[model samples]
Target: MVTRREVRLSPSNLNYEDRRCDRCFAEAANGESWPQGPFPGIFAKLDSQQRRYFTDRSTSDIDPTLPPGTLHNGGRVQSAPHAIGGVDFTIRGSMDALLRFDDGSVGVVDFKSSTASPQLGDAYRPQLAAYQWALSRPASDDPEEVSVAGLLVFAPESMVDTEQGRAYLVSTTWIP
Candidate 1:
């Protein structure tokens, strides 16, 4: 027994609202308190290069700052859901880069250039997990298997020591 006004005011049946990720909400809240993002304007600066090199999966000159590994290819992939038991769970996500091995299997790679230390907390976990989760889901038409392996690449900014007049660099990678 519910009134029209009550139903109108409280739209609890909305899918978007109902599927809100608690971790995202909490992280957003925490982010509000922070002064800056991981690498302010880093993504923007890399946009053109990312679109050209990564999205196209073209081999570019290896970044000297990056670790000693031959970069094969890189690109982004979007995954759509088909069905999920009683409930229909549709997830959408994009990866920065997907690297392939000479043998087989692809690895999801997300590139990031930062001035701050990487935060590998649950907040960042779900974001990356969503990408893996979506990538794991079978394509809308294709019902075959999907790759779930991936990596996060963080290339820190190069800083020159005024006292020593030498350049120093730091980089890190995470896989899950």
Candidate 2:
């Protein structure tokens, strides 16, 4: 009997060469090693706050281009395991948010933190595209129609001393 190995793919993985590294794929398939990163507590807190704000208000003060929609918080999205080059792979990701538009379309939004204004360069495009692809899949809930995808980047613009303590001036940038 022929056996097909399973591998998991994520948006972050897609950011790196579309997760085509044979060695990494093999390791992940064997359940030996997977991607790891330093914990981002501050970013997580900020992301949670923003998500809650949008969810509570049913709107976003940051991105005006976003249509009237209901914000769905972070969740796991996955594609059925499939074979690529004889290796079975399941593309999956924890999307930051999915906006279900009134017109039966969905919008993908990713939150990013940086010291300077975020740029929509080559490094980040694949990650956003992966989210767009995941949301557009027929298996996804709702209409599964991806109308738009974007990044909501938060950056520190300045620092100032206040009566309480030092405060940083933050700026938000939306890149579609």
Highest TM-score: which candidate? 2
lDDT of 1 by residue, 1-176 (tens): 53221111011112233226665444443333324347557466664454455443322233333333334333333455344343334444455665443334444555544332335332244555555555565345443232443334556557777777875464544544
Which candidate tops lDDT?
2
User: How high is the lDDT of residue 123 in model 1?
Assistant: 27
- Estimate, for each residue in 1-176, the C-alpha lDDT of model 2 and write its tens digit: 98876766677666645456778755664677665687678877888877776663443565666787677785878765556887876668898877778888877778777533334445578887777666665244643778878776778889999999997788878777
Error of 1 at 159 (Å): 4.3
Query: In candidate 2, which residue ranges exceed 4 Å CA deviation?
Result: 16-30, 34-37, 56-60, 115-121, 138-143, 159-167
Superposed on all Cα atoms, model 2 deviates from the true structure by an RMSD in Å of 3.5
Q: Report how far off residue 76 is in candidate 2 (Å).
A: 1.4
Point out the worst 10-residue segment of candidate 1 by lDDT: 4-13
Which residue pairs in candidate 2 collide?
A: none
The TM-score obtained by model 1 is 0.47
CA shift at 108, candidate 1, in angstroms?
A: 0.8
